[model samples]
Target: MMGVVYTTFMDMVAERFSEDVLDEVLDDPGLSTGGAFTSVGYYGHTDMIKLVVRLSQITKLPVDTLIEAFGEHLFGVLVGKYPTLAEGRSSSMELLEVVDTAIHVEVLKLYPNAELPEFRCERLEPSVLHMEYRSKRPFSRLALGLIQGCAKHYGETLEISHESFDSEEQYETHFTIKRIQ
Candidate 1:
């Protein structure tokens, strides 16, 4: 995983919880980096899992809920860092349609080794989008949250539903997003 993800997660922890809580979350002896992450340094994906699990335990929130919330926070962080990703995009579907093709392409230019989830999107109707997400990591809920964040960013309301398939090799999810208002 990219270091920016880990760093952004840590930043979200500090901002949503507290500096002291962030310290507590980072005190895990099992963390390979000792909770020290840099935006330009790579780390194991398991490290992020451990941190999120720890945060869930401390906050009494479900792991999925925490991960989804983190994804929403991450979207904001990414947009703040790279404004062009959302620039000239008129709607959530418009932005999402190019995530894999344009946005991830830019990301790969910066970090060639970054492993990003694949998104296959199609417009089912003028107000509806069908998207399939495939990833080695089980983060469909995170993707959902990111989608929600994108809709919110565009001041749009969406009704989203998903079905997931999990296997030893990968996780796949099909999402249907409809503009409700």
Candidate 2:
């Protein structure tokens, strides 16, 4: 994971929870980074997982929920940091369909060491999008939250359906998004 992710997560926690809770979570001995993170650095992916787990314990919210909320919050940070990516995109679906081909490509250029999820997308109908998300790490809720955030950002509403599966060999999720006017 990149430090930008950790920094956004820290910002989200501090805004939603207390700054003290963020401090306490970072203060835990298990984190190798000691909770000090910079947006331009790289950190172990496990560090983020540990922090989210600790935050979940403190807030009594599910870890997945926290991750999803963080994803929603992270989208705003991403837009603020990378406005060119959003420029010329008129709708949420327009932005989402190009995530793998455009946004992730730009992301890799900026943060070469970053590990990102794979999103296979298909436009099944004029207003419907079918997508499959695959990642070694489990963060489907986060992806869903991102999808919701994008729709909100574009001033659109969607009916989203999804399924998740985890086996020894793989973790995969399928999402069906239908734009609603």
Task: Name the top TM-score candidate.
Answer: 1
Error of 2 at 54 (Å): 0.9
Among all windows of ten consecutive residues in candidate 1, which has the lowest summed lDDT?
147-156
**On residues 1-181, what C-alpha lDDT tens digit does candidate 1 reach at each position?**
8888898888899989999889999999999998788988999888988999999889899998999888888888889989987899998989999999999999899788998999999999999999999999888988998998888788899999999988889999999999998
Candidate 2 is scored at a TM of 0.94
lDDT tens digits, residue span 1-181, model 2: 8888898999888888889999988988998877789988889888988999999999899998888788888887888889998889999899999998899999989877778888999999989999999988887888888988888888899999999977776679999999996
Off by over 4 Å in 1: none
Candidate 1 lDDT score at position 116: 90
- TM-scores, all models, native as reference: 0.96, 0.94
